[model samples]
Target: MGVAYSVGEVDHLYTFFVQWSPNIYRKRNNKSSSEKDMATKKTVSNSKASKKWEIITVKDSKRRLSLCSSVDSEAEEYQEEDDALPVLSDHSQLLDDHHLLKLAAHMPPRTRGYRWHLVYSTAIHGSSLKTLYRNMAGLDSPVLLVIKDVQKKVFGAFSSDPFKVSKYCYGTGETFLFSFNPDFQQYRWSGENSYFVSGNLESLQIGGGGDGFALWLDADLYHGASFSCPTFKNAPLSTHEDFIIQDVEVWTVQS
Candidate 1:
């Protein structure tokens, strides 16, 4: 017969090319498993937006460390109220004679050369002139009097009767009336107790039995005397003798 019809047309065409090569390799392995599930959902949404930006950068670094510890505790309470406060002058009263002749006309001229020692006859009494005018007026704390000289003679000796020819001299004259003590040791001679005249005779001058005489007159030497203490209450005055005052006279007294 023609050679069995060409061997049955080569066995049908080799079984239709072996069933179309296994259906095109199962549709290319289902399109590579749907592109590996869309690249694992874009790497799990970029790891949840990088864990929500590291939880808002750890809450803005704990609110900048609690606002820098509340600005370092209000700058240490304004440096402890600028270290406290009070400075000069403030006690009450008792440093007068035009403020001791404006503090012996602003002292500062004693290159250290003067000494006429003879201290203590109660050391200038009146309870030490109220404790040297409450310590030169510093009321008893800050002081500084360096004037080196200022005087007026005859500090003591008043017995015209106990058989002593003529004695009644109380500090003679050249302007002498001081006050400074709150412990600068002592420097009192408020003319003995009181009298800065014209300012209306300040008082205390009897001069005999009731005993009184603390005078300080000098609206420019209007006349002055009385280094008294005929018993001015507590009495004190007699830094013996070394007259001449002024050089250093710092202030503050009355502790």
Candidate 2:
């Protein structure tokens, strides 16, 4: 009922089937290897893209920070330029141009841009305390008192209120004392005393405490004294504690 085959024919058919199976397996293996290679390439490309973005982000951040610092530096430079030298009404006998520049740099911010007007000068008005007081009358603005001693040591006081005869000490903490013994020195309120300034019929005082005065001027405006005082914590303003006044000037800052 079945057709008979020779052994050679059966062996030949088996050999053919085996060879064909191997070829199909090789093709499948090659396709899988190709897919794996493509996947690895895609991963590598994605990694490269991520690193590029990261580097760009870091660079952008640094650029922004540098820009901000540059802006701040420019703003600071502009502010310094705005604070120029102040204008004086006339030449000063006690203060030269260099001294005036240094003193102007230390004045209150509110008074920096205004003009300095000479109200009283011993060289012009003569040496008299009464005359000085009369010239300061009705002036509600700040005043600068510059004194040059016989030793040529220069010192001064910045008074918030005009000098006048007062029973009690009167002046704000804005009052300060300064000295220029070849170099400029400023003494601000020490917060140790409220005796910033006081005036009497006989004398005028800038600061007081510890049984002494920072600056004292006699009625004649010809003699003066300076000592370490609690109000400004300043050393003796003059070369000596008591010195003869060679020159005196009072300047008022005006609008």
Candidate 3:
């Protein structure tokens, strides 16, 4: 079935679409043939096909969810019993799966809903730490923060609490900054979200705050500093731009 639009709407759409378009329009039976060539360059990309699905069944006397991905009308599991997980070329896809699995591990066994799902992703929210924190306020769930450096390396951490302001702002060592590739490095929480890299040691990290979580990279302001508490303050900086705030997602139990 084709979409049905009113004659007035069709005309309005046509005129509005090509107003600033630079492409040459050709007439074929009174219709421009260039509509099919739209969206040539990708603004956003995802490795997993949109046609994803999940199902739960009784197996081994335990409930387990079977995730299915579509390829040429053929369905395949994300994690196969006999085969290892496929390495996705797209960072977004790889990150998405990692985030989901990280959250799911803390949730119910094969039941779903104990961990966080993507409520706020910087990829869609844009690159403002303040704005990112502002959008994530008041969600009652543990937060996970991830960042992709200009080095093209991906890393982040998991917080045990929701992003918010407390009467007291201090570190509880409940956050861990971890790497997703090359080296799986995870900094043990120092029992406080506040700390200093100390003595010319460069740092890259993230954490929760009075407002929300901070996603930053190598910042000069905190370069070789000393502090009394654990904190995630340095902004993300890369060789070119600051740091890429790759993603921020909340993990919550489904009530």
Cα TM-score per model: 0.19, 0.68, 0.39
Local distance difference test, each candidate: 0.33, 0.89, 0.42
Which residue pairs clash within candidate 2?
A: none
Tens digit per residue, CA lDDT, model 2, 1-255: 998889999988777876879787667779999999999999999999888774458889999999999999999876765565667787789888667777888878878889898989999999999999999999989999999998998999999889999999998988899999989999999999899888987999988877789999999999899999888889899889999999999999879
Clash number by candidate, in order: 42, 0, 22
Candidate 3 local distance difference test against the native: 0.42
lDDT of predicted model 2: 0.89
Per-residue alpha-carbon lDDT of candidate 1 for residues 23-45, written as tens digits (9 for 90 to 100): 67556667788788778888899
Rank candidates, TM-score, best first: 2, 3, 1
Question: What would the per-residue lDDT of candidate 3 be over residues 1-255, giving only the tens digit for each residue?
Answer: 889999999998877766645353324422433443333322122224433645545683252222222342243343331133223222342365554455344322333423235544546655444454455577655555555554565655565554443444323455555555553444555544453221111333344443423443333322111111235442322233244433333333333
Clash count for candidate 3 is: 22
Output the lDDT of residue 166, model 3: 42
